[model samples]
Target: MIHVLFVCTGNTCRSPMAAALFNHWAEVMGMSSRVRAGSAGMAALGGEAASEHAVKAMARRGINLAHHRARPVEEAIPKADLVLCMGHGQAQLLRERYPRFAERIHPLMPYAWGLRTDVEDPYGGDLETYEAVAEKLEETVQSVLQKLENSRET
Candidate 1:
């Protein structure tokens, strides 16, 4: 199985949301057996639950983030076949820290959509803000799924 890891600052918002969305879509597309996703934070205190807004926003999309527990980046990186970060800075930092996995580490937007942008963090944002982030993540996740599919065909 191909393990995709989503990384963010705190794992309370963006990364977990992205992971849940990716897993949901992967299963929907019948790729769950071939690929799976997990999430972690660059500096997270392990065990914190996903943010309230994140859980609510995901619920809107029929995806659940209520059970997500924060994890440290180091714990997850070694297992990731591909590590997609929320921004360029995170990607750069991760590459520096885990040089052996540098080739597999990339910023999500540019890698998935060719956009030089960061996935906005909605840590303390309102529900609307969380929703917008979720929409962006959904788009990014769709692109990721397509790329995974294409890779499989080759």
Candidate 2:
């Protein structure tokens, strides 16, 4: 199985959202048994649920993220085969702090085909911003799954 971990500043928002989307995609593609997905935070305020706006935004897409709690990076990194970060800064931070695993870390957008932009944080933003972030994340997740599928076929 391919273990993928998504990381962000706080696990409450972007990372959890990405993990959920990817997990949902994996199931839809009939690859759930081949892929494992999770999320973590670089500097997490643990145990907090996703932002209110984030929860509602995901709900619109039929994704329920209301119960996700923040987790620290150290909690998830060691076992992940691929560690995808939301932005360059998060990737850089991981590389600097854990150079041994740096090669396995990458920006989520780039890892997701066609997307080269960073996934912005929507910590305290309104529903509109959360929705935008969710849309971008869903696009990126599709691309990411494509890449994974391609690699598996090789």
**Tens digit of lDDT per residue, candidate 2, span 1-154?**
9999999998988999899999988899888999978999998987878888878988998989988999899978999999999998889989999999999999998777646678999988888988899888888887888889989899
Give the Å error, residue 89, model 1: 0.2
Q: 1-154, model 1: which lDDT tens digit per residue?
A: 9999999999999999999999999999999999999999999999999999999999999987888999999999999999999999999999999999999999999999999999988888899999999999998998998899999999
What lDDT would each prediction earn against the true structure? 0.95, 0.89
- Runs of candidate 1 with Cα error greater than 4 angstroms are none
Error of 1 at 43 (Å): 0.7
TM-score attained by model 2: 0.95
The C-alpha local distance difference test score for the whole of candidate 2 amounts to: 0.89
Name the candidate that leads on TM-score: 1
